[model samples]
Target: MKVVVGIPSFNNAETISHVAKVAAKGIMEFFDGDGMIVNSDGGSSDGTRERFMETDTFGVPKESFVYEGIPGKGSAMKAIMEFSLEQGAQTVVFLDSDLRSVKPWWVERLAGPILRGEADYVTPFYLRHRFDGTITNNVCFPMTSALYGKKVRQPIGGDFGVGKKLLEIYLEKPEETWKTDVARFGIDIWMTTTAINESGRILQAALGTKIHDVKDPGKHLKGMFLQVVGTLFELMVTYQNRWMSVWNIEDVPIYGETPEEEIPPMTIDVDNLKKLAKETLVVPEYVNESAVREVKEDGTLSLNSWVDLLYRSAVQYRKTRDKTVVENLLPFYFARTARFAEEVKSLSDEEAERYVYEQLGVFLERKRLLKEEWEVEDKG
Candidate 1:
């Protein structure tokens, strides 16, 4: 079967060469060099394209394309998809350019399931620092798990593999439906969610330790946060019927070994996040100001507080059909993360996972409230 490895890059001059070389090695070693490395760039000005092309491919075919139309990882991925389709590739695997710890095993392990017809899609199951991927730890993972009843740990993890059938189905989606966030940071979650909804065979491949350019949610740009969370909300609305009927949560089949190396825990900059939230917060007139005061004064927020916030906000967004309503929930999101980070700073991964799992129960418990809010959605 023809295999294609896709790397979506932007300003990745620091790490692109290493990632590309390892990926090429995986393809050459495992697939007998029958595959090609397609580097799809988002017009990186840091000479990322040059560095990627300069990387030794060990006789494997390599091509690089820079998108002049729109600048986003999703755009690059779309180009890669088109390229793979034209090449008649049966399996396509993607990895982010910033992955410093990705090994050759990652490529074959992620794509193997697809190539062998064992699975239609594969997601990376990375051994990351407990504090890394805060959004996934707190929101995306739990929300996706609760909704779909599948504990596919990283629904939005950037690295994954998909087959031609899945690729064709994705390409058939209306451009307007995904041209926004899905065209950017929302791409991973969008694909994962759609895959789950379609009942495709999805597998999680172990990727050892995923050490990459970790972004501190608090100090990082809000564009991605908004886009990811916004896309998540949109998907929830679109798949409400399916998730609403989900009665139990289950685990997906995992196909790799956990890393044995002792990974040091990542730290959270709570003080900086506190400062950022205070500086950037623009409270909507509809939020409960008193609850905001309580969170600000002591960094203490309850489960009900989050449920109420989500419930009311989801209602408002559904009613108004305005993105501002969904975006307005970001402040509370920031506050909640800040507080939770402090709580889990000293905790182990097992401890942290327990905390998040319990918290997800609260979300399920209060989902009826969201249903109630939906019933009386204010169109005013």
Candidate 2:
């Protein structure tokens, strides 16, 4: 096949059909009915696979099946990668099943760069609500830009396009790799970081506004937070040689025209978030004592203190590789997120977007400090 579009799904029955239909239309309309759609399901009891198989595809070939290995987006993606490679596909596009804002052009937007041989990997760039992706806004985007020197706005945006070469690299990863956080929410970041360090070319696809099933950070994202952040810290240790020398950030090429959409307001329970942060914060031994004390007194971690905690914790993680290091950082993350919620609550989406970039600038400025700490550990 020339192209294979993969949708990794689990219990997404309500939205899978629509996503699959749109994907099929994109494939047929753009690829002249030359592409295939594969639904890699995680054995959903909610009949998600059945719903996907039932979607009308405008003559595009589609199949849905339960994937093997542990039940996670990563495992399902592994299965999809295997299938896409088996079909001799040249370009592979993966879309999350829960997307409500996906359009037919999304398929082309994601896969076009790879098919045109212009890039090896394509990450999505979307205009999301300020509060929608707190993790991305506060941590992943900035940290990725600072450490890896690529301004990939959405490293874990979940929807992406990969060429055959990149797919082969993913499949080549050892089996033990999947048994960790990569088997869960860590998959997106793992793929992105791998591309960043290993691939020759990477870029972004401007997909306009992404209106997915948004989760409030205070309530719905704890487990996901642990997994994604843990995986990121692990990658930082693993790729120290790659990022330690990256002193300047470079812009990644963007593929499509970015569209403007009126973002819908997302409600966040700030008081509850504050409560959670205050209640859960138990400053680990590795963190700066004074910063923890300030956080306790102020009821929130200021950006500078949060950076100190992260930098110190990352160095400690390098020393011990303990999961607890990442676990202990969670409360601080909650505190930082709560602070962010209050900071951006009154700003327009565009203004809030600029605020996020400004935060990225802080991370960029502090890169020297992180490098100094990491170098000290190396010499010690």
Candidate with the greatest TM-score versus the true structure: 2
For every model shown, what is its TM-score relative to the native structure? 0.93, 0.98
Tens-place lDDT per residue, model 1, 1-380, is: 46899999989999999999999899888888889999999888999999999999998889998864456777789889888999999989999999888888888898888888999899988777777887887678877887788888888899989999999988888878556788888888888999999855899998878888878877784778788878887887888778878757788899978767656557777777666556556667667776578567755445567667766776666666688976776666777778788788788877876787777777777777676666565333
Query: What lDDT score is found at residue 84 in candidate 2?
Result: 92
lDDT of 2 by residue, 238-331 (tens): 8999998888889898988898777787888877777887788886777888767755766567888887788888889888988888889877
- Model 2: weakest 10-residue lDDT segment is 291-300
Best by lDDT: 2
Task: Report the C-alpha displacement of residue 343, candidate 2, in angstroms.
Answer: 0.9
lDDT of 2 at 369: 89
